[model samples]
Target: MNTFEKAAHFALTAHEGQIRKANPIPFILHPMEVAQIVSTMTHSQEVMAAAVLHDVVEDTSVTLEEVRETFGDRVAWLVEKETENKRHNLPAADTWQIRKEESLLDLKNCDDKDVQILWMADKLSNLRSFFRSRLRDGDRMWELFNQKDPEKQKWYYSKILELCDQLQDTTAYREYKILLKAIFSTDAINLQYQTGAFHFEV
Candidate 1:
Protein backbone atom coordinates (compact mmCIF):
# COMPACT_ATOMS: atom_id res chain seq x y z
CA MET A 1 0.00 0.00 0.00
CA ASN A 2 0.98 3.62 -0.50
CA THR A 3 1.68 6.17 2.23
CA PHE A 4 -1.91 7.37 2.56
CA GLU A 5 -3.28 3.85 2.64
CA LYS A 6 -0.67 2.69 5.15
CA ALA A 7 -1.34 5.68 7.35
CA ALA A 8 -5.09 5.07 7.16
CA HIS A 9 -4.64 1.48 8.27
CA PHE A 10 -2.28 2.52 11.05
CA ALA A 11 -4.65 5.19 12.26
CA LEU A 12 -7.62 2.85 12.19
CA THR A 13 -5.76 0.26 14.24
CA ALA A 14 -4.43 2.82 16.70
CA HIS A 15 -7.77 4.52 17.25
CA GLU A 16 -9.65 1.24 17.60
CA GLY A 17 -12.68 1.46 19.89
CA GLN A 18 -12.22 5.19 20.47
CA ILE A 19 -15.17 7.47 19.76
CA ARG A 20 -15.36 11.22 19.46
CA LYS A 21 -15.89 13.06 22.71
CA ALA A 22 -19.61 13.60 23.44
CA ASN A 23 -20.50 11.94 20.11
CA PRO A 24 -20.97 8.36 19.07
CA ILE A 25 -19.07 8.70 15.81
CA PRO A 26 -15.90 6.60 15.51
CA PHE A 27 -12.70 8.59 15.98
CA ILE A 28 -11.17 7.37 12.73
CA LEU A 29 -13.88 9.18 10.79
CA HIS A 30 -12.41 12.49 11.90
CA PRO A 31 -9.00 11.75 10.38
CA MET A 32 -10.68 10.34 7.29
CA GLU A 33 -12.60 13.58 6.84
CA VAL A 34 -9.41 15.55 7.36
CA ALA A 35 -7.62 13.57 4.69
CA GLN A 36 -10.49 14.16 2.29
CA ILE A 37 -10.29 17.87 3.00
CA VAL A 38 -6.54 17.88 2.49
CA SER A 39 -7.06 16.19 -0.87
CA THR A 40 -9.25 19.09 -1.94
CA MET A 41 -6.25 21.40 -1.44
CA THR A 42 -3.27 19.33 -2.61
CA HIS A 43 -2.42 16.00 -4.15
CA SER A 44 0.76 15.48 -2.14
CA GLN A 45 0.74 11.97 -0.75
CA GLU A 46 2.88 12.87 2.25
CA VAL A 47 0.51 15.60 3.31
CA MET A 48 -2.53 13.38 2.83
CA ALA A 49 -0.87 10.56 4.78
CA ALA A 50 0.06 13.00 7.50
CA ALA A 51 -3.53 14.17 7.70
CA VAL A 52 -4.74 10.62 8.30
CA LEU A 53 -2.04 10.03 10.90
CA HIS A 54 -2.19 13.44 12.56
CA ASP A 55 -3.81 12.41 15.82
CA VAL A 56 -2.13 9.05 16.38
CA VAL A 57 0.79 10.27 18.45
CA GLU A 58 -1.32 12.80 20.31
CA ASP A 59 -4.35 10.61 20.90
CA THR A 60 -3.00 7.08 20.83
CA SER A 61 -0.03 5.06 22.05
CA VAL A 62 1.63 5.45 18.64
CA THR A 63 5.03 7.14 18.68
CA LEU A 64 6.75 9.54 16.29
CA GLU A 65 9.58 7.06 15.96
CA GLU A 66 7.13 4.46 14.78
CA VAL A 67 5.63 6.85 12.28
CA ARG A 68 9.02 7.84 10.95
CA GLU A 69 10.15 4.26 10.67
CA THR A 70 7.04 3.26 8.81
CA PHE A 71 6.27 6.32 6.69
CA GLY A 72 9.65 8.02 6.22
CA ASP A 73 10.82 11.48 7.31
CA ARG A 74 8.57 13.81 5.31
CA VAL A 75 5.26 12.25 6.29
CA ALA A 76 6.43 11.98 9.90
CA TRP A 77 7.44 15.63 9.92
CA LEU A 78 4.02 16.66 8.69
CA VAL A 79 2.45 14.57 11.44
CA GLU A 80 4.76 16.13 14.02
CA LYS A 81 3.73 19.59 12.88
CA GLU A 82 0.13 18.59 13.52
CA THR A 83 0.82 17.07 16.95
CA GLU A 84 0.39 19.04 20.19
CA ASN A 85 2.32 18.67 23.43
CA LYS A 86 -0.73 17.81 25.48
CA ARG A 87 0.49 17.95 29.07
CA HIS A 88 -1.18 14.66 29.79
CA ASN A 89 -0.76 14.74 33.55
CA LEU A 90 -2.72 17.93 33.98
CA PRO A 91 -6.39 18.40 33.34
CA ALA A 92 -7.03 18.92 29.61
CA ALA A 93 -9.30 21.90 30.32
CA ASP A 94 -6.56 23.62 32.33
CA THR A 95 -3.98 23.17 29.61
CA TRP A 96 -6.21 23.89 26.58
CA GLN A 97 -5.34 27.56 26.05
CA ILE A 98 -1.59 27.08 26.41
CA ARG A 99 -1.62 24.17 23.95
CA LYS A 100 -3.60 26.17 21.40
CA GLU A 101 -1.32 29.19 21.91
CA GLU A 102 1.74 27.08 21.21
CA SER A 103 0.11 25.55 18.14
CA LEU A 104 -0.89 28.95 16.74
CA LEU A 105 2.61 30.32 17.36
CA ASP A 106 4.16 27.41 15.51
CA LEU A 107 1.76 27.76 12.61
CA LYS A 108 2.44 31.50 12.50
CA ASN A 109 6.20 30.98 12.26
CA CYS A 110 6.29 27.97 9.96
CA ASP A 111 7.07 28.81 6.33
CA ASP A 112 5.81 25.60 4.77
CA LYS A 113 2.43 25.85 3.05
CA ASP A 114 1.94 22.11 3.61
CA VAL A 115 1.78 22.69 7.37
CA GLN A 116 -0.91 25.27 6.85
CA ILE A 117 -2.82 22.83 4.66
CA LEU A 118 -2.74 20.19 7.36
CA TRP A 119 -3.95 22.65 9.99
CA MET A 120 -6.70 23.96 7.79
CA ALA A 121 -7.88 20.46 6.96
CA ASP A 122 -8.05 19.40 10.59
CA LYS A 123 -9.67 22.58 11.82
CA LEU A 124 -12.15 22.70 8.98
CA SER A 125 -13.25 19.19 9.91
CA ASN A 126 -13.66 20.37 13.51
CA LEU A 127 -15.62 23.46 12.53
CA ARG A 128 -17.88 21.38 10.29
CA SER A 129 -18.60 19.09 13.22
CA PHE A 130 -19.27 22.07 15.44
CA PHE A 131 -21.63 23.60 12.91
CA ARG A 132 -23.61 20.37 12.60
CA SER A 133 -23.83 19.97 16.38
CA ARG A 134 -24.83 23.60 16.89
CA LEU A 135 -27.66 23.17 14.43
CA ARG A 136 -28.91 20.06 16.22
CA ASP A 137 -28.24 21.07 19.84
CA GLY A 138 -28.08 24.88 19.89
CA ASP A 139 -26.16 26.54 22.75
CA ARG A 140 -25.95 23.32 24.72
CA MET A 141 -23.44 21.96 22.21
CA TRP A 142 -20.69 24.11 23.78
CA GLU A 143 -20.85 21.97 26.90
CA LEU A 144 -19.39 19.03 24.95
CA PHE A 145 -15.92 20.51 24.53
CA ASN A 146 -13.02 21.02 26.90
CA GLN A 147 -13.23 24.75 26.31
CA LYS A 148 -16.95 25.15 26.77
CA ASP A 149 -17.21 28.89 26.26
CA PRO A 150 -18.17 29.83 22.73
CA GLU A 151 -16.09 33.00 23.13
CA LYS A 152 -12.97 30.95 23.81
CA GLN A 153 -13.81 28.66 20.89
CA LYS A 154 -14.26 31.78 18.77
CA TRP A 155 -10.85 33.06 19.77
CA TYR A 156 -9.07 29.89 18.70
CA TYR A 157 -10.94 29.47 15.42
CA SER A 158 -10.69 33.15 14.53
CA LYS A 159 -6.94 33.03 15.05
CA ILE A 160 -6.94 30.12 12.61
CA LEU A 161 -8.87 32.18 10.04
CA GLU A 162 -6.40 35.03 10.49
CA LEU A 163 -3.34 32.83 10.25
CA CYS A 164 -4.70 31.03 7.20
CA ASP A 165 -5.78 34.21 5.42
CA GLN A 166 -3.22 33.55 2.71
CA LEU A 167 -5.28 30.54 1.67
CA GLN A 168 -8.36 32.63 0.96
CA ASP A 169 -8.50 31.50 -2.65
CA THR A 170 -9.10 27.86 -1.79
CA THR A 171 -12.59 26.38 -1.51
CA ALA A 172 -11.58 24.75 1.81
CA TYR A 173 -10.56 28.08 3.26
CA ARG A 174 -13.75 29.77 2.08
CA GLU A 175 -15.91 26.99 3.50
CA TYR A 176 -14.02 27.19 6.78
CA LYS A 177 -14.57 30.94 6.99
CA ILE A 178 -18.25 30.59 6.14
CA LEU A 179 -18.73 27.96 8.84
CA LEU A 180 -16.88 30.12 11.36
CA LYS A 181 -19.19 33.02 10.67
CA ALA A 182 -22.25 30.77 10.65
CA ILE A 183 -21.46 29.50 14.12
CA PHE A 184 -20.05 32.69 15.65
CA SER A 185 -22.20 35.24 13.78
CA THR A 186 -20.72 37.33 10.97
CA ASP A 187 -20.78 40.67 12.81
CA ALA A 188 -19.11 39.33 15.95
CA ILE A 189 -16.49 37.46 13.94
CA ASN A 190 -15.80 40.53 11.81
CA LEU A 191 -15.34 42.74 14.88
CA GLN A 192 -13.09 40.22 16.62
CA TYR A 193 -10.89 39.79 13.53
CA GLN A 194 -10.83 43.47 12.71
CA THR A 195 -10.00 44.72 16.21
CA GLY A 196 -7.63 41.87 17.22
CA ALA A 197 -9.74 41.55 20.34
CA PHE A 198 -9.74 37.76 20.59
CA HIS A 199 -6.66 37.51 22.82
CA PHE A 200 -8.29 37.52 26.22
CA GLU A 201 -7.38 34.75 28.70
CA VAL A 202 -10.07 32.08 28.94
Candidate 2:
Protein backbone atom coordinates (compact mmCIF):
# COMPACT_ATOMS: atom_id res chain seq x y z
CA MET A 1 0.00 0.00 0.00
CA ASN A 2 1.04 3.61 -0.52
CA THR A 3 1.29 6.34 2.11
CA PHE A 4 -2.37 7.40 2.10
CA GLU A 5 -3.60 3.80 2.15
CA LYS A 6 -1.30 2.94 5.06
CA ALA A 7 -2.43 6.01 7.01
CA ALA A 8 -6.09 5.25 6.42
CA HIS A 9 -5.61 1.71 7.73
CA PHE A 10 -3.74 3.00 10.75
CA ALA A 11 -6.42 5.61 11.47
CA LEU A 12 -9.20 3.04 11.19
CA THR A 13 -7.47 0.68 13.58
CA ALA A 14 -6.59 3.44 16.00
CA HIS A 15 -10.12 4.86 16.07
CA GLU A 16 -11.83 1.47 16.34
CA GLY A 17 -15.16 1.61 18.17
CA GLN A 18 -14.98 5.38 18.64
CA ILE A 19 -17.93 7.51 17.58
CA ARG A 20 -18.42 11.20 16.85
CA LYS A 21 -19.35 13.35 19.82
CA ALA A 22 -22.38 14.99 18.18
CA ASN A 23 -23.61 11.86 16.37
CA PRO A 24 -23.33 8.10 16.18
CA ILE A 25 -21.25 8.18 13.00
CA PRO A 26 -17.98 6.23 13.17
CA PHE A 27 -15.01 8.45 13.99
CA ILE A 28 -12.89 7.13 11.14
CA LEU A 29 -15.29 8.64 8.63
CA HIS A 30 -14.34 12.14 9.79
CA PRO A 31 -10.70 11.68 8.85
CA MET A 32 -11.68 10.05 5.58
CA GLU A 33 -13.77 13.12 4.73
CA VAL A 34 -10.90 15.36 5.76
CA ALA A 35 -8.53 13.44 3.49
CA GLN A 36 -11.00 13.74 0.64
CA ILE A 37 -11.23 17.51 1.17
CA VAL A 38 -7.44 17.72 1.23
CA SER A 39 -7.30 15.90 -2.10
CA THR A 40 -9.33 18.69 -3.71
CA MET A 41 -6.60 21.18 -2.84
CA THR A 42 -3.34 19.28 -3.37
CA HIS A 43 -1.91 16.15 -4.97
CA SER A 44 0.68 15.51 -2.25
CA GLN A 45 0.35 12.01 -0.87
CA GLU A 46 2.13 13.15 2.28
CA VAL A 47 -0.49 15.82 3.00
CA MET A 48 -3.29 13.34 2.33
CA ALA A 49 -1.62 10.81 4.63
CA ALA A 50 -1.31 13.46 7.33
CA ALA A 51 -4.98 14.35 6.96
CA VAL A 52 -5.96 10.72 7.60
CA LEU A 53 -3.56 10.40 10.53
CA HIS A 54 -4.07 13.86 12.11
CA ASP A 55 -6.19 12.78 15.05
CA VAL A 56 -4.35 9.59 15.98
CA VAL A 57 -1.62 11.17 18.07
CA GLU A 58 -4.02 13.66 19.63
CA ASP A 59 -7.02 11.41 20.28
CA THR A 60 -5.53 7.94 20.72
CA SER A 61 -2.62 6.40 22.55
CA VAL A 62 -0.48 6.59 19.40
CA THR A 63 2.69 8.68 19.64
CA LEU A 64 4.23 11.08 17.10
CA GLU A 65 7.34 8.91 17.12
CA GLU A 66 5.28 5.96 15.93
CA VAL A 67 3.87 8.03 13.06
CA ARG A 68 7.34 9.21 12.12
CA GLU A 69 8.76 5.70 12.18
CA THR A 70 5.95 4.36 10.04
CA PHE A 71 5.30 7.22 7.63
CA GLY A 72 8.61 9.13 7.61
CA ASP A 73 9.34 12.79 8.48
CA ARG A 74 7.21 14.90 6.11
CA VAL A 75 3.98 13.04 6.78
CA ALA A 76 4.64 13.14 10.51
CA TRP A 77 5.39 16.87 10.43
CA LEU A 78 2.10 17.70 8.75
CA VAL A 79 0.26 15.52 11.25
CA GLU A 80 1.98 17.30 14.12
CA LYS A 81 0.72 20.67 12.83
CA GLU A 82 -2.82 19.27 12.84
CA THR A 83 -2.53 17.74 16.31
CA GLU A 84 -3.59 19.68 19.41
CA ASN A 85 -2.64 19.36 23.04
CA LYS A 86 -5.96 18.37 24.56
CA ARG A 87 -4.81 19.18 28.09
CA HIS A 88 -6.46 16.03 29.37
CA ASN A 89 -5.66 16.69 33.01
CA LEU A 90 -8.14 19.56 33.17
CA PRO A 91 -11.79 19.87 32.25
CA ALA A 92 -12.02 20.18 28.49
CA ALA A 93 -14.34 23.16 28.65
CA ASP A 94 -11.95 25.05 30.87
CA THR A 95 -9.07 24.43 28.49
CA TRP A 96 -10.95 24.88 25.25
CA GLN A 97 -10.19 28.54 24.53
CA ILE A 98 -6.51 28.24 25.34
CA ARG A 99 -6.14 25.17 23.17
CA LYS A 100 -7.82 26.89 20.27
CA GLU A 101 -5.70 30.00 20.79
CA GLU A 102 -2.55 27.91 20.71
CA SER A 103 -3.70 26.19 17.57
CA LEU A 104 -4.45 29.51 15.90
CA LEU A 105 -1.06 30.85 16.94
CA ASP A 106 0.64 27.86 15.37
CA LEU A 107 -1.30 28.24 12.18
CA LYS A 108 -0.57 31.95 12.04
CA ASN A 109 3.14 31.46 12.61
CA CYS A 110 3.71 28.54 10.26
CA ASP A 111 4.72 29.50 6.72
CA ASP A 112 3.83 26.25 5.00
CA LYS A 113 0.73 26.34 2.81
CA ASP A 114 0.22 22.56 3.06
CA VAL A 115 -0.40 22.92 6.78
CA GLN A 116 -3.14 25.42 5.96
CA ILE A 117 -4.66 22.93 3.54
CA LEU A 118 -4.69 20.23 6.21
CA TRP A 119 -6.22 22.55 8.80
CA MET A 120 -8.89 23.88 6.45
CA ALA A 121 -9.77 20.37 5.28
CA ASP A 122 -10.28 19.15 8.83
CA LYS A 123 -12.32 22.25 9.73
CA LEU A 124 -14.45 21.97 6.60
CA SER A 125 -15.33 18.41 7.51
CA ASN A 126 -16.28 19.62 10.98
CA LEU A 127 -18.42 22.43 9.55
CA ARG A 128 -20.19 19.96 7.25
CA SER A 129 -21.06 17.84 10.26
CA PHE A 130 -22.12 20.91 12.20
CA PHE A 131 -24.34 22.09 9.36
CA ARG A 132 -26.09 18.71 9.12
CA SER A 133 -26.60 18.51 12.87
CA ARG A 134 -27.83 22.11 13.04
CA LEU A 135 -30.40 21.39 10.35
CA ARG A 136 -31.71 18.52 12.45
CA ASP A 137 -31.21 19.85 15.99
CA GLY A 138 -30.97 23.63 15.63
CA ASP A 139 -29.12 25.60 18.35
CA ARG A 140 -29.40 22.62 20.70
CA MET A 141 -26.54 21.04 18.76
CA TRP A 142 -24.04 23.26 20.59
CA GLU A 143 -24.74 21.39 23.81
CA LEU A 144 -22.78 18.37 22.58
CA PHE A 145 -19.44 20.15 22.43
CA ASN A 146 -17.03 20.78 25.30
CA GLN A 147 -17.38 24.49 24.63
CA LYS A 148 -21.08 24.91 24.35
CA ASP A 149 -21.03 28.62 23.57
CA PRO A 150 -21.79 29.16 19.89
CA GLU A 151 -20.03 32.54 20.04
CA LYS A 152 -16.72 30.90 20.95
CA GLN A 153 -17.20 28.27 18.29
CA LYS A 154 -17.90 30.99 15.77
CA TRP A 155 -14.78 32.86 16.81
CA TYR A 156 -12.59 29.83 16.30
CA TYR A 157 -14.01 28.94 12.89
CA SER A 158 -14.07 32.54 11.75
CA LYS A 159 -10.43 32.89 12.66
CA ILE A 160 -9.72 29.84 10.53
CA LEU A 161 -11.47 31.48 7.60
CA GLU A 162 -9.24 34.53 7.99
CA LEU A 163 -6.05 32.49 8.38
CA CYS A 164 -6.79 30.34 5.36
CA ASP A 165 -7.68 33.24 3.06
CA GLN A 166 -4.57 32.33 1.08
CA LEU A 167 -6.50 29.28 -0.09
CA GLN A 168 -9.39 31.40 -1.40
CA ASP A 169 -9.14 29.99 -4.91
CA THR A 170 -9.60 26.33 -3.89
CA THR A 171 -12.96 24.59 -4.02
CA ALA A 172 -12.45 23.35 -0.46
CA TYR A 173 -11.96 26.91 0.78
CA ARG A 174 -15.01 28.15 -1.10
CA GLU A 175 -17.15 25.42 0.47
CA TYR A 176 -15.71 26.28 3.84
CA LYS A 177 -16.61 29.93 3.38
CA ILE A 178 -20.16 29.09 2.36
CA LEU A 179 -20.62 26.82 5.34
CA LEU A 180 -19.25 29.48 7.66
CA LYS A 181 -21.80 31.96 6.37
CA ALA A 182 -24.63 29.46 6.58
CA ILE A 183 -23.76 28.49 10.12
CA PHE A 184 -22.95 31.96 11.48
CA SER A 185 -24.99 34.40 9.43
CA THR A 186 -27.66 34.60 12.08
CA ASP A 187 -25.10 35.40 14.68
CA ALA A 188 -23.69 38.06 12.41
CA ILE A 189 -27.09 39.66 12.03
CA ASN A 190 -27.82 39.49 15.73
CA LEU A 191 -24.55 41.26 16.43
CA GLN A 192 -25.03 43.80 13.69
CA TYR A 193 -26.66 46.35 16.01
CA GLN A 194 -23.65 46.29 18.30
CA THR A 195 -20.81 45.72 15.79
CA GLY A 196 -22.47 47.65 12.92
CA ALA A 197 -21.56 45.03 10.36
CA PHE A 198 -22.32 41.47 9.32
CA HIS A 199 -19.20 39.51 10.16
CA PHE A 200 -19.88 36.32 8.24
CA GLU A 201 -21.07 37.53 4.86
CA VAL A 202 -18.98 36.08 2.06
lDDT of all the models against the reference?
0.88, 0.90
What does candidate 1's lDDT look like per residue over 42-70, in tens digits? 99999999999999999999999999999
- Per model, state how many residue pairs clash: 0, 0
- Cα miss at 180, model 1 (Å)? 0.1
User: Candidate 1, which segments miss by more than 4 Å at Cα?
Assistant: 186-202
Candidate 2, residues 110-141, lDDT tens digits: the string is 97999999999999999999877776676888
TM-score of 2: 0.92
Model 1 TM-score (2 dp): 0.90
Q: Candidate 2 overall Cα lDDT vs. reference?
A: 0.90
Instruction: Give the candidate number with the greatest lDDT.
Output: 2
Q: TM-score each candidate.
A: 0.90, 0.92
Model 1 error, position 37 (Å)? 0.4
- lDDT of residue 152 for candidate 1: 90
